[model samples]
Target: MQTISKNITTLLLLSVVFSFGGCKKFLSVTPSTQSVNPVTIKDFQEILNSDSLSRTQFFPLDLMTDDVALTDNQFNTGDNFYRRIYTWDALIWNPAQIDFMYNYSYAKILQMNVILSRIDAAKKDALNTPQTKNLIVSQALTNRAWYYLQLVNTYGAAYDVSTSKTDPGVPLVLTPDAYALPARASVEQVYGSIISDLKKAAANTDMPSKGIDIIHPGKAAVYGLLARTYLYKGDYESASLFADSALTQESRLLDLTQNPYMPNQLQDLNTNPEVLLGRISSDEGFFKTYSNTFVIGGSLLDSLGGFSTADKRFSNRFSTSRFSPGVYKQNQLNAQTMVFDNSVAVPEIMLIKAECLARKGDFSAAGDLLDKLRSSRIINYSPSGRTYTADNILSYVIGERRRELCFHGGLRLFDLKRFNKGTPFRQSILRTSYSGTNYAELLPGSVLYLLPLSAYVLAANPNILQNPR
Candidate 1:
């Protein structure tokens, strides 16, 4: 594990070097006979394709949400960082602690910015044709938008149109100037910039049909991201349209029942047809701890109801660990290390479209979409028994979303925030230890839902403001 961590760090450092010093430094330091840095299109693509840079850290996100809980012994002996996050402590941003989520996000953003800044030079050098250059630029823009979306959602507040203008978002760093210390942008500005980047990426028709690797964002991935962003912002019409666009490009659902069992399954990139894009954590120890310490919340298990038997997800994704009896721990990937599927998958897109249709009062259309996904997961699903009306359609869709998306890629926390805007859909999350003696609660609309920026960030950039406690 230590070796793996070192390798990941080395890759990130390499990415940083290429991003900051690639072409310019080579031109200055190399002999006239030597070739310049990033002399070809592949050089730029290689930087964007770094596995370490693309695999985001959202393990802390899983701990902060209600989907997971600690065993009695695990809770007592857990690291301070995990404990603090699990309890929703206001002081979780200690500078001494390693905030992988913050650091990795910014690192990838820097890499994307560097690529975007140097792409023009690559074009002028004739290393890439006009079409290839446009495609490369589009990929960079998509990556930049994705990284910013992760940063703002993690370090800043959820998108609330009423308060977005006043809310502190992550700093919008669009250039490769590492020394520049910019103040945090408003949430509105950050989201607008993300939308703009995605629009540009989507407009590029020459983008490769699919990424050479799942880490490289493709045209469908672009549309999928746009759909996700609009969905988070509560724009149902745009979400539906973009989701439709993405599905048209690529729609492949992994039939869980068909391939029900596999040993040490890590959900590798390009292996799953459902995955339009994919990322997995490099922190092996974090995943081992998560699997050993955490179990599904009791309430969540009950919500599974009959579906727990009919749906292969229940048996496939979880198991009763020897650490505790009757306690179920998540093992979706069937690996000791955490390998999350962060890409836009078919099931997620379907749910997004269903929810949007429900919002627009298209009960029949929404119900059909929901039924299609449900039928895929449920062993003996019968549509005749499943009927949804407008009043109950949204509720059903949201419930299915919870079941389908939990523990995959930190969707639980984001869903909690996005749906907790009002009284009707607001949720209060409760987590209890194995003995049922120790517990934590995160109420709906609580300021704690918005994680604070790392103390290291605030110390370095005095102009940056912290999220409210």
Candidate 2:
């Protein structure tokens, strides 16, 4: 997230989505486009099992935050270009990100819907202790919720807590169709459907709560997402409760018990125990980048007042050099840098707890929680300096999130919009340096930022509505 921080060396854009692919498995879509036997559950699940599909699912796949990368040196809306996303001024979408967002996302949504439709058929038993069919249904609902949530974020606006209940959101399509165009739904309706799906996910106690649900849906994962939806809606009490629910069973945070900043430890950036949910993306074509073209790691020391000794991220994670920030990456990389990999850590539930509490007006309590995380991540601990008046506590919380949650996923951009902090970066963002989209400004509540309606989408639903300019 930092232009380049001290120790963090990985390019966040590589895995900026919910996931970055390992190129571990090639995708093989079922039904072969014409085999037409009403796509079975296992067949659909097999498609979901592909490494590409797992890495490129909704919400996680399309991250355009302050931390991610662009395909071109500059932000231009063209084939395979990330920078162009900054300029929606072009007559048409750059197509790569857009096609993935609208066409691919909806296609995935249809896949989930197909699985959901046949969940009952998959169930051979009426009363089962633990059945595969039940798992499929529960997971399908959860996946559907997540996919729609991602769709909403791309095509729709950031969830507005004040008017979301009355706001129109994206269409909640469950069943697949070759024909049948749909219109954009209200934000309220979109969130409503997503919540309903999550409830189904939470209710299914039979499901396990383990690692990332990139392949399918997990109860804990759904709860984790629900927590975000609630946070976006400004419903802190629920957000806190759900975040607690997600983290209650396990702790996936990087286990940084061993001193992280020790130089020897810095050599093995990939295995740093602090990573909770990380993906090393070898297929994103980062290794090909020139060695010096890597994400700057030591920028924090230069920018954030010489990197406070108390800041754990600087002391432990960054390595300063004359050129690059050298935070986590021991060496630098350039385009065609496939020998290396990109990663994403699905941040711990503990941070979300702090965020939800801070949003809820419990500044004293929130500060205590935030400090707990800060202490763990810093070279030195000073609780005395952590005190905050209620007035400035939220700002402090937002700042802490920026530091702790940088370059993890698509979060920085969303965080900027939610707290209304994009103005600071409008001109200062170093558009040519990183996140190359030369967005003169982060569009505040504009229709342009909304995903362009796909041609298929427009043709299907005659009554479908386009986003307002």
Candidate 3:
């Protein structure tokens, strides 16, 4: 088992160097009515690495539902329904969310397949030369796995213990072959496939430190992703352990005191030690709502005790400018964002560790691990300051996670779904329609987790299984 894992990791690294794409092409692609393979690494990378591509293709429902604020659209069909559909706090996501996803990911999958096929067939000299050959292959495989993870998470149902084998999930697209539009597998199969990809990544890749350039995923990033996958699997022990592995490589938070809060600074283009992976994955277009000037959402505000002044979170993490009676300030989008996209740093690992520990009922270790994070970012570190109980400690941990991690592109919706809180779309909406909803309104057991397989995918591969609502 161990030997196989190592060989796969080596392959993943070769894949990364092989996985080159430009920002523009990565986001958008028009698939052939019939299955076709892209010609080269550059072509394949263009589609896979694109921010527009990733935003549109990578993970569609993440923001629209509630891991973060939904981008406002005049189109009115998307996140707009957060309030209405979730009127019961019952989350009925846009079926159309699956449209971009199916197209983009399969396009990526195809590109990867072409690369993989070429890798297998290329002359030994071409494949072995440049030292980077292995790196590129490793990258390609990891990215392919990434696409699968996103597709499954959005479209598939939660992985249930007893019924996962019987439950519906997204199609497991391994080969980019045109003939292979597969059917929906069980949720177990989807996760199993993701694990396989990460295992490949972990074994084959060599992490390049954030020395000259830091935006790309290398060894640590893939390992971190593996840790994340384990967490989602509810394998608390493995999750915490894998997260530790990632952290051991790169573990430091951005120094709030010394660093400037200017837009460029947030990127830490240096691939600051704080960041474990690529600098950032650009979301499509500027995020609709988040700005450097953050306004408190009424739900968040009320939860904060009263004024933005009331919660240390509002005061410490964000700089607020008031407009209406309820709304406060949050991140405002502008030009500098393009130069530096979203980057994942070490605190994510800390939270992963803390949460996984808490899940295991190891409250003392979890609380200790979690509080240390709060202690650093915040002033006045009295353990009992926030009225500490195990649950209180956990809530504070999550609250800190929410406040500290917002707009930076961390796991907000994952937490929601993991905890089964996917329905209540209410929090901080400038638009009233989406606000005012509460927890009880969100229908937890409803078919909320399912995502429709897009028309494009169905058209291309009539065989692809649809996740039924």
Candidate 4:
């Protein structure tokens, strides 16, 4: 079936498994019509292998960021929910319409929950032993934790250590009961659970360093998720440690200078050795669709342009050919086929390490790390001779982060949100519409950055309150 359920309750009631499909309605669950009850280890593996789960992360959420801009025509005629998100509207969806972002995320969570709930009792044989069950549990936990991170970052406030305990996060549904109407957990609680799940996954030494495919979460992927989680929580030291641990397992970077292929290594997950885990769009011709609707924002294009022509990413990852004369759009989000790679790649982990070092006031080390990454993507890249100070190092890394991770997985938005939590890292974004006359500015403290809970969800479950407008 194409859809799981109509709302969160239905999502809890059913498990969705399928070839990739549209995100039109992925929110609900109905056992009678769409559920696949897992009774065997092989069955659980099949559920985990479904492409639908990979497509459930923040791929579409990029539409809301400063890096993308809608044409005036598309702004008025495109997906209504996306149009609202583009302008930071207080409400992006009506009570009747499905919030695919919310639905798809919880849909994956539901399947993970289903597996976790059933895997223990699943039949074991020669190939499926107790160790196999442990590995399966670990993968499910890791996948669940990853999806929760996406949910909390999108639906909750930017994580502040001082306030996360009180900030409302998305619901923490850990069971397979379709009738469960879990209340929103505190951001702290959600993060706590995420860390706990990832830690458990990492503890399972029996798991492979890498999986059979990128879609599966291996030890490296588990560690990568941990690093990303700790980074979001502003625990830079922990982030750096886990990032290092992850790189120890998988550190290959796709050298843009050496790859002469038309699409390059970054476009295909299978070809990229750097990818620790793979999550992707629905192979739904997303870029082709985006080309018709949006252009890369001028400011981002300018930032990409400022990097020297030696920088292969700027040339290979983007193009003006998709749009009119001067308008540019990202080209490497996916290959000619579809499927955009949203995996936690080595570059992102490297960037994480670099940012952590900069935060520790080790500018020289941070710059060296940053330069190492730049050298891989840019030919004949010389290390910066400019002396670095605490004043500029983090900002420099942040800029590099925007360039390196932009449009990858709604990451720029996440970076912006986290930076706004406090201090010199705080940023403000002014979003100008396709028509320059209208503008919406998101300050460091603006509630506009936080997406509200889906109205349909609120109407269906009274326990779940909406985020502050």
lDDT of each: 0.72, 0.51, 0.53, 0.73
The C-alpha RMSD in Å for every predicted model, in order, reads 6.9, 10.6, 8.4, 5.6
TM-score of 2: 0.70
Which RMSD does model 1 reach against the true structure? Answer: 6.9
Tens-digit lDDT track for model 3 on 1-469?
Answer: 9768755664553344233332342213332212133344444334334433233223234333333232233223344433333222233434444454465566566556666667544444432543445555666676677667666666666555677787767777665333344777777888887788767766763535331234346666676777777877778788888888878777776654344332333233453566654434333333343332213444455544555343354454334445333322223464323222335457777887887776656778778876677655544555775555565556656666665555443255455556663323223322333544333323344454455555556666676665544
lDDT, residue 17, candidate 4: 29
Between prediction 1 and prediction 2, the one with superior lDDT is 1
Better of 1 and 3 by lDDT: 1
- TM-score of each prediction: 0.87, 0.70, 0.71, 0.86
Stretches of candidate 1 off by over 4 Å are 1-39, 123-126, 261-267, 287-293, 306-308, 320-336
Off by over 4 Å in 2: 1-48, 57-80, 87-98, 123-130, 165-168, 211-217, 256-319, 326-348, 380-384, 421-439, 443-448, 454-469
Best by lDDT: 4
Tens digit of per-residue lDDT, candidate 1, span 1-469: 9768765664565455544322311111221111224545666756655554455668778778877666677677755677788889888866765566776677667767767877777645555787878887898898888878877787777789899997888889898664568999988999999999999998987886567656667888898889989998889899999999989988877777676632232235557777676655433655455555356666566656632366766655566345453344334555455444566677888899999999888999999988888777778788898679989999889889888887655677888888787837887877665555657788898999888877787787898888777
Clashes of 3: 59
Cα error, residue 358 of model 4, in Å, equals 0.8
Worst 10 residues of 2 by lDDT: 6-15
